[model samples]
Target: MMLLPEGSFDFALQDVLNRNDHFQSVTEGDACVGKVASLLLYVEPVMADSGCLQVLQRFVSDETLQAVAIVDDKHNAVGIIDRGKISDIFLRPFSRDLLGKKAISEIMDKQPIVVDIKTGIDDVARIIIDSGVRHMVNGFIIHDRGVYVGMATGLSLLKEITHRKQRELFIMAHYDLLTGLPNRLLFKDRLLQACQNAKRLGHLLALIFVDVDRFKAINDSMGHAFGDKLLQNIASRLAASVRQSDTVARLGGDEFVIVLQNVKSSQDVCGIVGDIAEQLRQPIPIYEREIHVTTSMGIALYQDYQDSAEELVRKADIAMYEVKQRGRNGYLLYAPDMEQQDDIRMSLETQLRMAIDGGELSLYYQPQVDLKQNCMIGVEALLRWNHPNLGSISPAVFIPIAEETGLIIPIGEWALKQAVQQHLEWIAQGLPPLRVAVNISAVQFQADGFADKVRRIVADSGIDPAYLELELTESGVMSRAELAIKTLTDLRALGVKLAIDDFGTGYSSLSYLRRFPIDRIKIDQSFVRDIHNTPANEAIVKAIIALGDSLGLEMLAEGVENQQELAWIMSHHCREAQGYHFAKALSPADLRSWYAQSIVIKCP
Candidate 1:
């Protein structure tokens, strides 16, 4: 608690503190605030006994309150023992005579800085902070009725300021910084408190974590800061929309948490949650942009699966993820069955982990063909998990769960290694050294040493660095630019290729694509799924291909389910395509056979 000089990061502390738009206020030579018309009458007992020392003792004792003693024979107040003087005097030495002190005139301070009652707390806080004093003295200095009122200290004001700042900072930390409301941190704290309360009161504390579905689309179409301000504006409305006791927190990105306190039944959680969903159904205007987002809420209550806050948060987070799985804009209360869903998904995650350990996980390549040249230019390495009991689990079910649970690190690594090795084998067999593209999840990409992992894998596999390819989502690229740049640079250095996967469905700033060291972009399947039917889909697809073409980056079409889709892709001059049309991710041996047994395009 002590801001000791040794452990201090003096100047750095300011950056830790949030700045205000307006400056703080100040009032000089203000009257010492008093409760009574008569000031001296209050201090009469102290003056009669030990005037100056009594005031000094009282002032230093309470860091928050400030006071001064006026001393003189005629009570003309020749000098005063203000807070600073008293603090200094108290720090000097302890004395028994401090009690028997005569008139305050002997030890009172003559002049002291005082702020008026109208002075802003910010200005008052700054003075004491700048002065290095624990407290700032404030109030009416001269008595209106000749009776001196009590003084307020810088320490007290400072403590109050610091406490409030801590709360505000905590709000910014865990909650939405833009909204000035409870953030994820606050939600976590509240969830923890709820768990404790639930145990004590034997009541159910329901944790419903909500994510704004397609929120990124809104933010991407608009702007992020605007997205932030929109979040802030809606957060207050959301708070007002809910019950006074219920807690709503923005959990960063588009995710949010609502802790329903003292729930006796699932109905209680649902009824309020239904109302919360209704409130957010309307569109929010961000500048001239009318932005829209829907909520997918996952609900979990305390004492169900967890007795603690972290468990509650984890369960709620899991449930929230389920809501997204079931399709956004709906609420799914935490069901015991949901754990089954998590278990099945986690079983796959666990299996993926074990697969790596058991050597059951392998990577299969889908050749990326240059339809024009009719040659396999690159191969996208698709991950395959062959479980002992379950056989083959679908990536559709597990990939997301892996990404969410952060199991993708090891799994992605396994895939990366396999891809590099496969590319190396093709080259060793005198086959064309086509680029081997491996998918990188946002979590895996964000991980520290991800680039290094790729470097290590390429080196270990003895593959040409340029033949290794990394595929990422558009949003994935923008999430952490500095880190992404580092990752891409390292891979690009290895002569590895970096491709943006499912390109259109992200909050990508076109400027960022230029910023990132990306070499290719694969149009998402949804845009390509019915690109022929939907003008929007076709337009989006064409624009992306054009953008990639103009950037001189290779463009690949995903989810080419039919010949018509393939013909359209080929006509558009897309360099490559992958989906159910070419082949769903196949088995390693099957993939090799599919590539090898068929017509092998002769290299030039």
Candidate 2:
């Protein structure tokens, strides 16, 4: 309905406007997000008996008024007047003059779509759509207890619904569904915000990267359902471990991140980290099982805003990997040297690529002796690298890099070829035949057609496969025992002698020992280092020797560097041993001389 004279409608408007504050309160709260009252606009209502000129004057005074309510003497809503219709009517030549004096009810909509203020915005929107799109031009009257209260426009309704949908979409995109924590996208955003806050407040920001240790193993063994429950439990504990100002986020899988703002010092971070570690150490009950998990955390601090959010996260990730490398279940602060070490590792990996082609790599022979016979029985071939610029690089440092880079396969092939050729040369020189042991890395062993490659190498060498011994780490074979079993069987079929290297240091299980096809168990150096004094080492060595005896396999003690260590293995009935005490890894010439001397001593 058209508006009445300002003075005439003022009385009705005042009566309805008195309830506007209550309507405002309902619209602003969370519970009323989709309620019709949220879209209510309090426009002065016109008296039903007023003239069209009075409505015209009221529209002129309030330029933003989209529509007006027509109410009766009791303030009951009767009809609605749209601004568009009135403007159209009055704009036609002298139509306003002819119709402006008529009663506003004569031209107004007698039955407008009036919705109760309590109705949902969706319901009212549906009503508008079903009634016709024309109803949106003038909107509709909103009332309470049959009394006209306000008008709700189509524009405001659309915006409110759109805003709510956007909020829902935002939550879905930014949060992890399972853990209900910020995912990587949102974590980066929060980290940037935290960094800004820290910079503004002139305080330190600590970025912590957390990785659940051996999570894949647990996930594979316990089933995905149990793994999911464990992750949720961990998420809850991690959230509880921090303050309200801090943010804990899951970067997917078992990786989580945390941002701590206003950190006072490294000690403050240490205390928080210690608490987190302790919290994670507690057993989590899932599926009637008390599951235990340990985390490796790496913390990178922004003291002077030197690192961006991304750089901070990267540095923390690098530090976390360091913890994994050293051993799992601990934390490491991001040190400058750690980054430097990472750079060096990357550089070494690049250099190793050229190493095989550049002839920088070679093999050295360390003699394995028969302790009782006091004579050499075999030699273990170790890979050595002499970089053109860097004098010598330990296999301990470069082998892992090669494994990670997939460079180990070619390098391993090279070593196998060289060792076999060297053995053939020794035989050609009329030296006594001895088993030449060459170590095989896990990646090179598990590679497709590995056995076939070994067969090809053995055939090409024209040397007896009996003289070639392949030394595999205990953990390397035991990690995937079934695959290893098949591979070992294939190698055994080729008549190559097999030995388990570094025994008693990794998955030392009797089950795999019975299942695997062959030969010797080499006691790791750690067990042999102080075997006479350390009961644990002595016990481990004795157990290995006994296990080898039971399996009808030879037992060789590695790292026998002293008379006491050598005497201890000999007393334990270990027949073979190798270490610096016997002779260091030597060149072919030195090994030939040492072999001749060893034969003379044994014969004498």
Candidate 3:
């Protein structure tokens, strides 16, 4: 047999055959090639009038000749006859004798299954199977550029199809479909290999677990498609931020794992982590909007932990969770003691869940006085929890846990209901009409139907909405500024007053402050605490006061513990004050008694 395109034929044929060796035979349901040009077998044909039987016998005798391509005078493929078709004719007793004298074209198939060279093997196989052709006497003809290139056997197309499927399966198992990064399985495998390398070299290796902060909130507010796009964008940024030697992988759902090999020192790890965090801090464009996201990272050192890859990953996860607990958008190095801290927090959370129903939670009220009148104008309600096992857990500790665990919604509601009931009791007892302010958490404030819930609670308590004031921290309001404004507007429509509780402590935009339907600004206790000693504190307080005054809003000072701070507050014409200088937060009954005592002293 002669190969086509003469000199180039053998090398190309050998290469195709070598690559095809790795492919298994095509099984049922496999994708097969419609036409394979590389497997084409071109055979010289015998003349029709010249003793075709002798030529056919010679073709059958040749071991490599499976089929013979019969061409017209112009060398174009006109018909084909294979060993199987010739065997069928000779098997019949009288058939070969009667037709032996006829031309070879008369015995050859007039029309065979002709297909394009580029068509898929599965389609070719289906067409052949559907045609009820029990055996392929003449294999399919392959054409490229509308010219006959060669013919392809059923077996060759099947082998190539199986090979492609195996390659696809391998890729799907190792890589994340959306981000094209290594999945957890691949990451863990690489991490194990990296750990071995680090141990042998006596070097440090760092594994970082990253979680995108507030991702669920963004996903819920926007559609999941948008969330997916956001994650993809974040994946690209994370990949670009790390060293090429490091492996960045997606650990599913807004979480990523990075393995840094051959680390020299902790400082090197810190620099890399900082760069990754800074990269994520930039705004990402998605769906015609710029969505900003921050990442919380936890780093575990292989040299320090000396654990298995799975254990190291678990430690890194714990550290990342710690950063989230510490208010997110930060990183923490793993320490063994953090495990104990986690256990303690878990215990406290369990106890706090039962605190409310167990009758261990109560409110303490601190009076806010009008300095000019020397009388209490309002009271701020604070929560206190006395645990059965642990006595008197501080609000600073438990409040945050409640917020994190979503127990704040119920706890905050309880506080609001209790405060309103107490104030109503005082009013019924013939006390002066005084407002009661309650601090609101960001989670509770942004919860669905929060404003409606507040309205219902105030209505059920039968207290005038004017006497109920809700305090929101600057950070809480500004986190979702537009939503805060809408919620605040709804609450104000119910006649309840709103105040920025810890003013000047967050990135509060002045534009948003002016737009919010706020009634007052309470200078944060941090600023008011050191006003007498710290010049910067005094300046900040004065500026806040002046800003509040210019906006025609009232200013209240908190944590004023002495006459010096009180005098400074009043000298600056501040409207209200709340601190231990006048009185500490007391129980409802003690507050009533303190209110009854008229203590008026002139400031010298």
Candidate 4:
């Protein structure tokens, strides 16, 4: 077999072959065979001793005669010649006269790249790039079982490879690797285009920002691989929930942006947002367990906002953060006033940091009374911040900010140390020993070496560990139940009492609750506030009391504001109660004075 450059073929013979039914049918087996056979020329090869002048004459006669094959007497391919080498020799002064009349084989390329006729177009492209030849004047030879078929051009193969590379580059730039959804770059481009269209057509467009709530917690607890799979699942659901005209894009890590074009009104946007939220809320099965997640969506209307695409997205982001602040699993529309509220929150966050350092934060104690004995037995330490300018700031306002900023870890530690030290001081003053319960933030509880830190603080405080009670919320304990069990057990070994606060608010598995080494459970105030009027609250409170009794753990009801509620709690066998019905949270000095003067004194 021999490689030969592309050459002009006899026009009459090519027409005859084109008209032949056999040739056309034979080419139908594999449509992708873009090889030398498809452009073959039937020109016969000259012998090694053939006149170079004659070959040059033939090349001059045929404009397409770029190269020709050389063969032995037995019809075996040996070498090839191209128009380039012939022109190089002839163009030099006196060189053509010296070498043009010699054998064409003298100037022929003896070794050339060859491939099978059935080789894929892709493989042929790779061969063209790998070969050092700038132009295959003598094109690559295609063979079938050692028989020469035809020649293939380097230009054609390179064009196909360039086209394929362009396509791949496009996909890489526009789509996310993990979710296969449009990435932020493409989303922004599409959002800009959609805004332009909406403005031109006088239609409403809504840009909805969807953020998965507590996704970092999920990712940290379940591992990133599972988190990636969860994102993919979420992307698919979002895609299925929207129309083909709408664009859903992943803005990296638990955040997706959707552009709803041609929306009728805010109501239409609301309906779509609701559907998307519901779709995301559906349980996604991961690693044999169903993982549940909810999305907080923020919608910004194009005409209503009258802003640039980037600004609209920013507004939507602000709204999404507002949803997160109001307790996630819902959607909110962007309002002008929300930005002001955000500024206030930022100011509060700044002031809070200063408060922590300036000793403006103090612990207020709320008495937890032993209702059965009609006496106070313990006090829950609640944190309070009094800013120099803003006066008393509610924990409900600053606590979430602290948690988000990770200041909760230090704040929690301070609260625990202060409560323990205060308890020790009371003991030194000859007062009865009482348990001092301090609420532990989830961040502080899950922190590395937290149990060890608590142990160190307790040892340093010189207070009996039994008097230092740590109150962990139900969601905090159940987030990582197995890990919580280990941590709780370690704290239990330190001799500090452990209790689950805001018990009925979260979904805590009973089996894990049993496994946790808890000394008591505090009924959340929401259930305890209207226990007399709301049958559901009454039943839940009763059930929790019974559950505590069955598990040999004490039950305490919070938010007891009147005799009726206290009577109802005591009637249901609740051992302890805490709320304004007895006394509100008081300063350390005021609490000491109140406890001294109070007629209700109980001993265990």
Best by TM-score: 3
Q: Which ten residues in a row have the lowest lDDT in candidate 3?
A: 20-29
Residue-by-residue lDDT tens digits, candidate 2, 1-604: 4544534323432333232221233124676566888888898899998999889888888898878989999988899888888888888899877987798998888889999889977677667656766676788889999988898886676566556545555666788878878888999889999988888989888999999976765676557998999999999999999998899999989999999988889999989998999999888899876866789999999997988888999999989877866756899999878988888887898999999899999999999888787888789999999999998999878887787567999999999999999998987897778789999987788777899999999988798999899999876787557778999999999999999998887765688789898888888998899789999888777777878889999889999999998888888799999998989999988999987775424422
Q: In model 3, what are the clashing residue pairs, if there are any?
A: 32-121, 32-122, 33-121, 34-120, 34-121
By lDDT, highest first, what's the ranking? 2, 4, 3, 1
Global Cα lDDT for candidate 1: 0.66
lDDT of 4 by residue, 1-604 (tens): 3543443222322332233132222224646544445544466566778988888888898987777777766555677778888888788898778886688778878876666766765555455545654444466665567655556665555444444445445666788878778899999899999999998999999999999877776787678999998998999999999999999999998899999989898998999899888888888988887877888899988985479998999999989988877877899999999999788888888888888889999999998899778888999999999888889988888998888778998999889889888898888887799889999998789877899999899778778898889999988888678788999999999999999999999999999888999999999999988789999998888888889999999899989999899889888888899999989999988988888887777564
In order of TM-score, best first, we have 3, 4, 2, 1
Better of 1 and 3 by lDDT: 3
Across residues 1-604, which tens digit of lDDT does each residue of candidate 1 receive? 5554532422433433446521121112235321112222233313523655556667657675445545344443334455565566556655436634565555655554344444555554455456543233432243334433444443444454555456545444554545656766667777677677778788877777777665554465346887787677667667886677878877777666777777778887788888888878766776765544568888876755345677667777778878866645688766667778876765666666666689877776776776777666777787777778878877787777666556777788777777777767766766667777788887777676777887777667677677777788876667556557777787787787788888888778777778788888888889998777788988998899889978889888888899888888888888778777766666556766666765646447
Model 3 lDDT, residue 329, Cα: 87
**Best-performing candidate as measured by lDDT:** 2
CA lDDT, every model vs. true structure: 0.66, 0.84, 0.81, 0.81
Question: How much is the lDDT of residue 141 in candidate 1?
Answer: 41
Instruction: Give the runs in model 2 whose Cα sits over 4 Å from its true position.
Output: 1-184, 196-204, 211-245, 249-256, 261-296, 303-311, 324-329, 446-452, 459-463, 478-495, 510-514, 533-536, 599-604
In candidate 1, stretches whose alpha carbon ends up further than 4 angstroms from where it belongs are 1-207, 210-245, 248-296, 300-318, 324-339
lDDT (tens digit, per residue) of candidate 3 on 339-432: 9877888889998898979999999999998888777889999999988788988997888788878899899999999999999899888777
- The pairs that clash in candidate 4 are 36-151
